[model samples]
Target: MRTGMTLLIKFILTFVSAFIAFDLLLNNDISWILLLSLVAMLINYLIGDLMVLPAKGNMIASIGDGLLAAITAYIFDLLIPAFTTSWSTLLWFAILIGIAEYFFHLYLKKDEKVAP
Candidate 1:
């Protein structure tokens, strides 16, 4: 693939993944997901080499993302008197993230195999 295309996909996927993860963060509203995603993306981008493989990078990202997502969800629930959450919200968030991850991986791998 062309370098430009790869970078573009990376930019788009990063935004999509972050947005979905942020939404999954709550039944109500909280903004911490924004900060958390920014932090995680920055840290990972800076240390991308340390991750070595896609799986390793994903593992690290997932931990940071998942924890931050949970915190954001909880905080949103805490602040909004009218908002309610289910214990299952966490599970749904996890599932949604997992799906997002799988698709992102597929897209990346496909891009790598295709001609520029």
Candidate 2:
């Protein structure tokens, strides 16, 4: 649960989840999805994890992450012609990312505790 490790896991999870989520939900170019995932992950980690998690709790932080993911995806889809998406698709991506984020937030918390 060191900072480095946590960030690594966060990046990996974000990348994988976003990649797969978009792949499953949208008709889009792989390159566009990858780019979008990186952007979303950066924002999610910065705002959702760094900002929200410390101020709020895991649930709120996870929700925030989901919201951020949904917004990011929507914006990207609008901007990128090849990235197609819908409301239901966005919600599905959010839900999936949020569940994964919850566990990542838990991992952060575990890192802070005193080991027995």
Candidate 3:
């Protein structure tokens, strides 16, 4: 239940961020944004939240999540011809995700079951 809730929140955050940064601003396709959000959420949840958050701590974990988001976006941009974005835009998107993840990490830390 806890993990489900966490993923839900993460998805919401990722979707909104990607929607604003990619779809709304850059005129990217909604379908691609949706796919990006899901992939980014799962990867960040597994690597950043589960592994890094528990081992390294919130600051590091959030940074990792941000980097993961940027990298994921960059890779998608490369693979999908319709997904267009610049480096500065990617950096801005990363910053947004990082800020959200910081607060999210705080919430996760409150729950003992989340970390260990």
TM-score of each: 0.41, 0.86, 0.93
- Overall lDDT per candidate, in order of appearance: 0.48, 0.81, 0.89
In angstroms, the error of model 3 at 17 is 0.9
Please report the candidate that would top TM-score against the real structure.
Answer: 3
Per-residue alpha-carbon lDDT of candidate 2 for residues 12-79, written as tens digits (9 for 90 to 100):
78767766677765656778777877888889988987889889999999998998998999999888
Can you write out model 1's per-residue Cα lDDT over 18-108, one digit (the tens) per residue? 5554455443343444444454334433343124225465555555444444455555558756544566765555455444444544555
lDDT (Cα, 0-100) at 81 in candidate 2: 79
Clashes of each: 0, 0, 0
Q: Which pairs of residues collide in candidate 2?
A: none
Cα lDDT over the full model 2: 0.81
Candidate with maximal lDDT:
3
With candidate 3 superimposed using the best TM-score fit, by how many Å does residue 98's alpha carbon deviate from the native?
A: 0.3
Q: Return the lDDT, model 3, position 88.
A: 78
Candidate 2 residues lying further than 4 Å off, grouped into runs, are: 1-4, 112-116
In candidate 1, where is summed lDDT lowest over 10 consecutive residues? 44-53
